[model samples]
Target: MSNIVIYHNPKCGTSRNTLALIRHAGLEPTVVEYLKTPLGKEELRALVAATGEPVRALLRAKESQATELGLNDPTVSDEALLDAMAAHPILMNRPVVVTPLGTALCRPSERVLELLPVGPLPPFTKEDGEVVNDSGARRA
Candidate 1:
C-alpha cells in the first residue's frame, strides 16, 4: 500500500484535480474508485473519523438521492447519514485524501495540501483559474 490513498471519483472535477495534485506532489497514491469499490459502514466511519469531520459533513447534500431520501434534513442523524452513504456511494463526498499527516475531504481540492508533508506542493491552477502557488497558497 502506498503511504497515501485517495477515495476518488473520476467524474468529479474536484476529485480529478485532487488526484492530479497528489501526483504532481511526487507521490503515487493508491486510488480507490469509491463508486465502484463502495465503502462499507465501518470503512466510512473510519474515514470520517480520520478527517475529524462528522459523518453528515462527509455527505454529498446535493446528490439527487439525498433529497429523495430526505438526507438533507438537519434532523438526520449521523448513523442515518452513514447508512445512506454506505448504501449510495455517491452520497459520500469525493476525493477524501488520507496521508500520514492527516485526512481531508478536499472539497476545494487544495485542502489536500494539509495531508501532505511539509514540502513544495505541486503548482496547479484550479478550474476556476485560481493558481496554487508552490507554498500551497492560492494566487490570482
Candidate 2:
C-alpha cells in the first residue's frame, strides 16, 4: 500500500479536486471511498489522530443528522462524535489526506499539498479557480 491515503467522496468537488492535485503532484494515492467503505471506529480514530485535529473538527456539523443527533452541542464528547461518525459516515468531513508529511482535512483541496512528498509540483488550480503554484504557494 502507498503511504498516501485519501478518504474520498467522488461526488464532492473538493474531494475530486484534491485527488486531482495528488495525481498532478505525481503520486497515485490509495483512495478510500469512505461513504462506500465506511470507516470503522479504529480507522476513524486513527485518521483523526493522524490529523492531530480535535475529533469535533473531523465532524461535519452541517450534516443534517448532526443537529438531529444533538452533535451540535459543545458538551458532546469525542467518543460520541466518533461513534456518530462511524455510524453515519456523512457526519465525517470529506477529502482527508494522509501521507508521510502528515494528515490534513483538505477542505480547500490545496491543503493536500502539505501531506505530499517534496518534489516539483505541477501547476494546480482548485475547482474554484484558485491557483497553487509549483512551490505550493497560492498564487494571487
Candidate 3:
C-alpha cells in the first residue's frame, strides 16, 4: 500500500497537478476520487482533522451547494459541516494530501510538496504555465 493518500478530483487542475508533483517525487500515492466514492461522516471528520485546519476551512465555498445547503454560513456547526461534506463530496476542497509528514489542503497544488518526503523536488510547470523549481519556489 502507498504511504501517501491524495483526495483527488479529476476535473480539478490543482488536483491533477498535485498528483503530478507526487509522481515527480517518485512516490505513487493512493488517489481517492472523492466525488465518485463519497466519504462517510467519520472519514470526513478524520480527513478534516488531519489537515490541521478548522472544519469550515476545508469547505469548497465555490460550489453552489455550499450556499444552497447553508454550509457557507459561519454559524454552521462543525458537525453539520461534516455532514454536508459527507452528503456532497464536492463540498470539500480538492487535493487534500495525507503523507507521513502531514496532511494539507493543496490549494495551490505545490503545497503537496510539504507532505512529500524531505528531499529535492524536481522542477515542475503547472498547466497554467507556472513553474515550480526544485526548492519548491517559482522559477521565472
Candidate 4:
C-alpha cells in the first residue's frame, strides 16, 4: 500500500462512492476536501498534468460561475482557467484520486478502482452505485 490521496467533495454522490470504493479496496487514502481547502495553482496544474488532460478538462463546466465568468468561451487562456479553478474550488472537478504510481479522475465511481492495488472491493450493488459518463451524469 502506498500513499493514496483523494481530492474529494462529500456533497457529490460520485465523490462519496469513490471514497467508499477506496475504503472497500482496503487502502487508506488521505481525503482532501478540495472545496474546503482549495488547491493552489501549482497543485492544480500538477494534477492536470498527472491526468494527462488539458487544464480545461479538469473544470466543472456545469458550475454557474464557469458560465458567468465565460469560462466556456474558447478565448479563455489556460492560465485563466487555472486561476478560476484555484479561486473557485467548485469549478475544479470532483474526486480526483492520486497515488504514487499514477493519478486518475474518478468521475465514474468505477474509475477510482483502477488506482487501487489489486484487491476485491466491496460488491457494488444497484442502490449504492452511480456511473459517470463524459457528459457527467450520475446514472443510478
Candidate 5:
C-alpha cells in the first residue's frame, strides 16, 4: 500500500467524500484537518510545486477573506496569496492528498484515486451486482 497523507477540511462535502473513497479503497491515509492544523508557508509552497499548479489555484477563492483581501484581483502577487493562505487556512482549498510517489488535489474527490498504489481496488459488488462507483460527484 502507498503511504498516504490527506489534508482535509471536514466541513466540506468533497473532503468527506474523499476520505470515504480512500477508506472504501482499503487504503488508510493520515488525515490532516488543515483548518485546525494549518500548513506552514514552506509546506504550502511545496504542495503547489508537487501539484504543478499556480499558487492561486491552491487557494479557496470563495472564501470571504479572499474577496476582503482583494485576492481575486489579478494584481495580487504570489507572495501575497501565500501569506493570506498561511494566515487564513479557511482560504486554502479542500483535500490535498499526497502519496509516496506524488500528490494530487482531490477536488471532485475522485482525483485522489489517481494517487493510489498500482493495482485494482478490492472487489465488492453492489446489491445489483454492479461495481460500486467510488468516483465522486462532478462539481460545477
Candidate 6:
C-alpha cells in the first residue's frame, strides 16, 4: 500500500480528477469513499488536524442540509461540527489527500501534486478539459 490516502467521493468530479492525477503520478492511493464508509468523529478530527485546517474548512457547506442542519451557525463548536459531519457524511468536503510529504484539501484537483512524488508527470486533462503540464502548472 502506498503512503498516500485520498478521502474521495466518486460522484464528485473534483475527486475523480484528483484520483486521476494520483494515477498519472504512477502511484496508487488508498481511496476512502467517505460517503459510503463514513469516518468516525475522531477519525474526522484527526484528518482535519492532519490538514492543519479548521473543521469548517473541511465542511461541504454548499450541501443542501448544511443550513438546515444548522452547521452554518457561527456559534457551533468544532466538536459539534465534527459530530454532524460524522453523522451525515455529506457535510464533509471531499478529496482530502494525505501523503508522507503533506496533506491537502484538493478541491482544484491539481493541488494533489504538492504531496505527490517529485517527478515528471504526463500532461493531464481534467474533467473540465484544462490541461496541467508535467511541472504541475496549467499549460498556458
Each candidate's TM vs. the true structure?
0.91, 0.91, 0.93, 0.85, 0.83, 0.93
Q: Count the backbone clashes (under 3 Å) in each candidate.
A: 0, 0, 0, 0, 0, 0
The stretch of ten residues in a row with the least summed lDDT in candidate 4 is 131-140
Model 2 residue 42 CA deviation in Å: 1.7
Candidate 5 lDDT over residue span 53-117, tens digit each:
89988889988889999999988998998888998999888889888657778787767667766
The reply for model 4, stretches above 4 Å from the true place, is 126-140
Ranking by lDDT: 6, 2, 3, 1, 4, 5
The local distance difference test score of each candidate is 0.87, 0.88, 0.87, 0.80, 0.79, 0.88
Name the regions of candidate 2 deviating beyond 4 angstroms: 136-140
Better of 3 and 6 by TM-score: 3
**What would you estimate as the lDDT of candidate 3?**
0.87
RMSD of each: 3.4, 3.2, 3.5, 5.7, 5.5, 3.3
lDDT of 2 by residue, 1-140 (tens): 78889999998999999999999887899999999999998899999998889999999999899999999999999999999999999889988998877788998887777667865586788778888776654312
Over the full model, what C-alpha lDDT does candidate 4 score relative to the true structure? 0.80
Candidate 6, lDDT over the whole model? 0.88
Encode model 1's per-residue lDDT on 12-103: one tens digit a residue. Answer: 99998899888878889999999999999999999999988888889999999999999999999999999999999999998899888888
Q: How would you encode candidate 6's per-residue C-alpha lDDT over 1-140 as one tens digit per residue?
A: 87989999999999999999999888999988988899999999999999898899998999988899888888999999999999999999988999887888998898888788655687899989999876653212
TM-score ranking from best candidate downward = 3, 6, 1, 2, 4, 5
Residue-wise C-alpha lDDT for candidate 4, range 28-133, written one tens digit per residue: 8998999889999999999999998788888999989999999999889999999999998999988899876578787877787666664444465422544322
- Candidate 5: regions farther than 4 A off: 122-140
Clashing pairs in 2: none
